[model samples]
Target: MRRSRRVRFLSDSDIDSGEDDDDNEDDGDGEEGSSAARRWRRRMRMKCLSCKEEYGGGDAGTCRECYEEAGETKEELKREIDDLKSKVNFLRLLSVGPGPAGTSSVTRPCFYDVVLVASDSIDSADSECVSIPAHRAVLTSRSPVFRAMLENEMEESLSGTIKISDVSYDALRAFVNYLYTAEACLDEHMACDLLVLAEKYQVRYLKTYCEKYLMSRLNWENSLPIYAFAHQHGATSLLDAALSLIMDNMDKLSKQEDYMELVEKDPRVVVELYEAYLSKQVNTAASKDPKGVSRYSFQEKRYTHDMHMNNIIEHETTNGTEDPKTVNFFI
Candidate 1:
């Protein structure tokens, strides 16, 4: 019995020894893995070149070489901008209108060859108009209208006095100054006047400038008149912006006084507004519907067709004439 018990104890001791060996191997592997993880973490940690702060690989933006290159590029761009500003300052001419003496300094025969007179100034018709002097080359370069008038040796060219009609003295002065310096102090009224002159003279730069100014100042109260004015002057950007504002507030459109005035003054423009709104609605409906057709769009089209038919019938009845050619349908 004692010999059997000794054999069992030896077998149990062998099992425990095997378990300790396996545990030692696992501990060695765990130590190696932890060491490797620490080395990897150290590699990922780096100082940011810009802020001088530690960050991991995931937080890194650019390498030191690329960051240095970006700094050089930014400095180069700043230098180029400064150079352009200097060139512009050098190219800009002095103001073309009256100087501190209340008479145009450009009137000197050596400096100026052309004079712009405001024919519709606030002054009485019998009074002499104030003439704003300008350089012919400057005017020609800025405006194609001036180029045509001057290069062809027209009556104004011969007389050296170009009479501008339907413009106030201040507006004409500002217009001429812009032709020289490409700069103007603009209020709403000045912007409107300059836009008209720019459109008439085909000065695209000034026209775009004035349009941007007006578009910046656009709001619900002034949108209708601005829309009408933009339409009249062919300012497409301003027109689209104003129309968008008007469309967004279509519910309140009829309540505005400007809407009444626009309806009375130009019914065609109102019709165009409705057409654009209907087109937008149709497009939205089409986008939402799977088959590219919507109930609202179909109903609107049918309603428009009925209105057209009614108009034609009413016209035929009033004139006591029948014309099949007048019948048209909206598709």
Candidate 2:
């Protein structure tokens, strides 16, 4: 006689429960093997399905609790109420174990640190496994245009098509690497570059991160290109948020000699903002010095004093030396 290769779960109590059936085991020779198989099936043990705590029965079979919990009758109100009660906790959606097929696990282990093809050996799963990059972000600089649109550096998305100069090449490489992996090792220089690349390439998540880093330093001097790009890209959300940010502090900023000086360069925006400020009739307490000089200052002062200013800026624009500290503000 042949035996089946597939083994079902088993339990000691199951063997005891089937003793009565064993009494009829020797009914006949031809039925002997079939009856044994049936006995074996009926006695096979398995774990409790719902609780998954130890207590077994046949494979694909339910335990007493599960069977009973199903209720003596579906319409029984007490059983229905009992069955409806669930333990409250965070809902875990991932399937949680090795599978029933081919004697293999259905999921990863607690100590598992990586993922790889089934064909790969355990040794190859560490460094060989794919993930985020480990280099600095592509966009590091702060910009006036990009700075005003962010609420949180980690969740903001850019609205337009903007390319970063003297930084795009490095930013693109770093940003693409980031997309494939979730990691980046950004420094101050390339933070904005990578951020702009993130925005340009639609890496919204990374762009958000860039925004956070930029917002800390965002000001009138650094938000223009990003704003231009935001408008160009039709980033309405970013544009509107930036405009609001600029307007919110426009009153305080108007009193800052340096901020106002640079802001006035954008004649179009200056007029618009001037009109808005006039409408509010803001009053500034930052009175000019006896020399009629402004008290507020630009943090990224290219020249400490006019005598020390350098004409060599990284980038030149229609207005003058293009500011390097552009922002991608999210917060």
Taken over the whole model, the C-alpha lDDT of each candidate is 0.73, 0.43
Model 1 alpha-carbon miss at residue 162, Å: 1.2
**Would you estimate the TM-scores of all the predictions?**
0.61, 0.29
Q: What is the lDDT for 51 in model 1?
A: 63
- Residue by residue across 36-152, what tens digits does model 1's lDDT show? 545544555567776676644544465556577788899899998997786464334433445564544543334657778787642555223376656788788888999999989
The residue ranges of model 1 lying beyond 4 angstroms of the native Cα positions read: 1-110, 122-129, 295-297, 300-331
lDDT by residue for model 2 (272-321), tens: 44444443332222243344433343222212322112211211234463
User: Where is model 1 poorest over a 10-residue stretch in terms of lDDT?
Assistant: 3-12
